[model samples]
Target: MTDTAPSESTAPQHDALLADLTTIRVGGPAHTLLRPATEQELIVTMRDVWQRGDEWLLIGGGSNMVISDEGFDGTVIHIATRGIQLVSQTDTTLSLRVQAGESWDGLVAKLVSRGWAGLEALSGIPGSVGAAPIQNIGAYGQEVASVLDGIDFLDYDNSEFVHLTTAELELGYRNSVIKEGRAGVVLAVYFTLTASPESTVQYQQLATALGVNIGDGVPVQQVRDTVLALRASKAMVLDPNEPDSASCGSFFTNPIVPEHIARALPADAPRWVVDDEPVADVVVPLGETPAPPPPPKPRLVKLSAAWLIENSGVNKGFRLPGSRAAVSTKHSLAIVNRTGADAAEIAELARYIGACVLSRYGIHLQPEPVAVGVELA
Candidate 1:
């Protein structure tokens, strides 16, 4: 593919693409914006956006992203590319390939309805399937990486297709090469799903809520439903009317500390083994674990970011003594738009909540949104 400059329009239509595209109703416009309906068009348009020396921001469902109020300076390519093909299937397994533009939740919904078990625990995360591996999106004790078999990407530096393995993705807590660096746009993803109804109920809260136990198999659809319900309760699922769900999912990855530090917390601090390997020895909860009771190690145990924020005195629907935005009334971790809000306002509010958490817990909270053009710092 080659670059081609878009027809000139000075009205900033390029940037307006995000006005309604993302969950946060904030952000400026891209100097140029294009939505490629197909891979070919996406590539061609992207080539032009790139070769023109124009800076670019690639957006998908815009759910998990937070753009700056100032907006993107270069071109913005909103990938609407689509396709979800079950290229092959077997009695106890399936080989599915999904284009980057496919809605992540929509696909999971379909798979669940079909009795597919692999992704049931990750049902409600907002964003496109392509963006899933970008941050190794996870929830309800499951992450996308567990089912990811291969990834197809457009390597930005080389401008070519690259297939990567799970190892190459370097999956970590809400982090991957794509989320951390300028990895090229994902084209499609290939997943090898199991045929048997194998699943891990690693999250204790979810199991208890579902009245199931860890390692006990449940219908994939049930898992999906339960997960989505749990997420909605936490304001993690996207809902137009729910202000808390308007922001990114979890605002921070659970902090994993050394065992000694984790053990230093009070007897009630939550602790769990991260791995079964004898060498594996780190466990701390961000405090989202349900039904486990308040972990004894509020200080030594990694407190739930939500718990810390609330306990630090920032209650739901909290606003600065004088501010427009507020914390979600339903979820403490989310900085929300109680009314019409702007990016700058959100950033300021986030900083306030973060400062309060730091002051009280001495733990720095990191945002989960892929902040762009905006400085949360």
Candidate 2:
């Protein structure tokens, strides 16, 4: 890779503290920190670290990570590369390739300004573009998976760069192959956005915020503005002045359970049918007869994690005695660092919340952020 002067934003640092880089502001220092400003530099640096078999971790935006207080023993590469290229455009649709390090909300804002639809409802979500597909980040009713065309990935297993399509990612509710076991890094993301000025609002909260009904079309910019306001009210947006914003967005993913288990919960618990098994279409040979199809399986229900936590006796702003970690004052789904909390305290609070929900509902709540050298148990 060719050497280039680093910008102020991409300059490398020695013995950098991970706490300064992460959103939660609690991780310990890194032994070494490297910031790669270009895609070529990132690849070369990562390959060298891999060849040496040195312990290494990739951090981008650092919004969805929780690192231990003892800190990591190896190199930490902070992705800083940035660029966006419009690959092709038509009257109705356009494709853009974005560098992995591009800010997600920044991209959404740009798209909204350009009258590009599809991502407006996802506004205000934090982190880098490359990290979006790892969890298939979604807000309101729009998810990155819905607009993603593919990604340029650097696979760690074979040390090769390959482009993979959206279907190949096997994306689902807050999950994908990358989050499962496919070891790799996303170098760039490709998105296909509509050229429409307005988008359909699908979420009830969003529709209400915009003073419209669900399924009604509203200006994309209006949708983005309303979503940002809603997130700010819940302290989901990142702001230095907002103490509750010092968190990893939603700490837990909504639990998806079987229909029977959902019915076991108290009435008025918010639950939605996420999916149901499809009946197979049986066909008999030219014999003019067909066998009956099997009955459909039980539907899966997604329960509101915030509602469960509240009902389980853990209310918003709840904190363990003598602990610095507490639930967000505005949103029960988030665990915020209330004044210099250590990673241990945060993990302890998470474990406590999980126990409460499990004891009350028999459903284990899964954490959304990736934990490093720390256990929620």
Candidate 3:
């Protein structure tokens, strides 16, 4: 796809470069940019682009992407549609159907203000609601996978609108079926939130910050405030004046490895048990009570990528020779564009970090963002 004249769209302009759209501010120009204001209009645009056999990309807030300096040689669709409707409400439960284009943090703030408790822990996260489920976005031990109930999307194979349930989405830790490169375009997302004044503090750090124990309930608004403050301290929140905020959040996800591999790492390395192998249940004869099973052994472990990077001797604010990219000063896991860093510099820095971790601990850290044309070779 080459640059062409502006086509009919809700928001159409000349060749808008990806650098101007992405949060990191590094990518090259895109062939074309299209923003649709309504679901019907977005569908029509998708169909038009497909029928014409043009390469296309769907961009939301552009928070979790790394495009190459060579730019994307395709049409870019920006989901600019916006609306939120309370689909259902009960004495204890409330359901919201939000447009994919709505800002994620904005939605969380709105819900928390109304005493909804499910998304308070996810406050201050960047990107759009439509992009949430694709990555099963999570923070502070609260994942969108828990609150997300359903999604309405334009199916890639038939160009027809389809609604899928949470189970069908197959959400996992920062992943879902959509991440497999499916062509479904999320038009809206349905979330079921608890109509409660308080939310459970599942994460240890968050609990400690709130002066509470794990599993304790804290006011929803307080949780949101605490989460935002925590994010700001790490420079994870977007701030134009803060150079460390110019990043794609955490560069690498916490690596989930087998228990044995995690045990091989240093004892000081932070780790969390993800899951354990199921133990066999005790069977009983008819009308008899069944016995409890023994404690299961942990089989999966979530290792801290940040710990690995720091322990590998890469300090915060580390940069390659003559490169504009560096690790965020406040957070070891983030890769920031220090001085108008291009995609190459970012990729180089990421490669160096990964190599360091691998050489030190034999664990290859993988990047979390979706790289368009740039790759960490």
Candidate 4:
């Protein structure tokens, strides 16, 4: 491979390059945006970025990030570096290592047809595989962490690339250390997926939405299709026509609060708390009181973030500062770029919305997308 080493006097144009990166079509130009084609290129690019002592952001599919319109004042390394190789597969399980730059939907679809079960439920997510574990990507009923075996990350502190186990990754609900952007850059990921006839439908919403159940043995293809359908309806899937899906999926990590908070609400409210622990999430009804509460269950009670956003009084198309950006008209949770918006406009809009929720509901809405060259408003 040839070298992409920037000279002492030359750097990639930050202006023309800024328009080329990101899903929202916002963000300012980078001092340099490196599109590495292979692992070697990725390494060299990263070394260049770090050695320059300039702030850097690694972009994948560009689906889950919102950058500031002010433009990144430092280097932006675009991981166009891509590939996927299946290491081995038995009659009931498949072990494959995927490059970080490959499209996630494409990867999941390819494996589903081959009868791989672990990733089928994660089919419609829009980022690269490298970012998958960083956020512990999940949908329907499964998180990528379940089938995940390991990851290859550039250990910046060590100045060397390293492999990490699922345990070491410390995966949680849509969170990982790498997703926090501490591991430098993710190059590839490994998964040990089930090829067996059995699949778990742990998410009750998924089963009810699809009209299926666990132990019923559904095909991987059916599950994938159903998940995509449901997500698309909610504007969670990227729909070029609908600005709502253009956002990072579900803007908040469902609040996991203490069981006491759940109990504080009226008995008719939909409250579910961890049975054995003090933690729980009471699914606050949307715009009205719920009919009746579901029975309490063990473990963390999963509540909907969207419900909270709507009840918080910030509706879709909520505008501020001349309408360059606003909440999507179809979905209350997504902050959308409208009418030639820039990164700063979106950042300010997010800040206003987040502040409103925190002030009124006491819920701090953590953004789902990674912010590049921008701080949460």
What's each prediction's TM-score?
A: 0.87, 0.95, 0.93, 0.85
Model 1 residue runs over 4 Å out of place are 1-12, 15-17, 197-200, 264-267, 271-276, 279-303
Please report the candidate that would top TM-score against the real structure: 2
Q: Of 2 and 3, which scores higher on lDDT?
A: 2
Residue-level lDDT of model 3, residues 1-377, one tens digit each, is: 22233336555554678887788887887888788767678888887788788888888998999999988788888887899998999999999999999999999999999998899999999999999999999999899988899899888788778899999999888888889767769999999999999999999999989999999988999999999999999999999888888899999989998898999988998998888655656668999877666556658899999999999999998998899999999999999986889999999999999999999998878899999988863
Lowest summed lDDT over 10 consecutive residues: which window, candidate 3?
1-10
lDDT of 1 at 285: 68
When 1 and 4 are scored with lDDT, the better candidate is 1
Residue 207, model 1: lDDT of: 93
Q: Candidate 2: deviation at residue 242, Å?
A: 1.0
lDDT of 2 at 222: 90
* lDDT ranking, high to low: 2, 3, 1, 4
Per-residue lDDT of candidate 1, residues 144-185 (tens digit): 888898788888887776788889888987888888786588
Off by over 4 Å in 3: 1-12, 284-298
Regions of candidate 2 where Cα sits further than 4 Å from its true position = 1-13, 277-289
Candidate with the greatest lDDT versus the true structure:
2
Q: Could you give candidate 4's per-residue lDDT for residues 1-377 as a string of tens digits?
A: 34565443233545545534666677777766666667777877677667767787778888778876666777777776678888897887788899988889989988888777888878788878888889898876688888899998887776577889999899888888776556578889999988754456667777886687754667778888888887777677777777665565665566666665555434543444534654455676589876576666645554556666666678877789576777877777777765777777777878887888777667677887777768764
What ranges in model 4 sit over 4 Å off?
1-13, 17-19, 266-302
lDDT of 3: 0.88
Candidate 3 Cα RMSD (Å): 4.1
Candidates 2 and 4 compared: the better one by lDDT is 2
lDDT of 1: 0.75
Which residue pairs does candidate 2 place in steric collision?
none
| Candidate 4 backbone collisions, by pair | 28-71, 68-343, 69-343, 69-344, 351-377
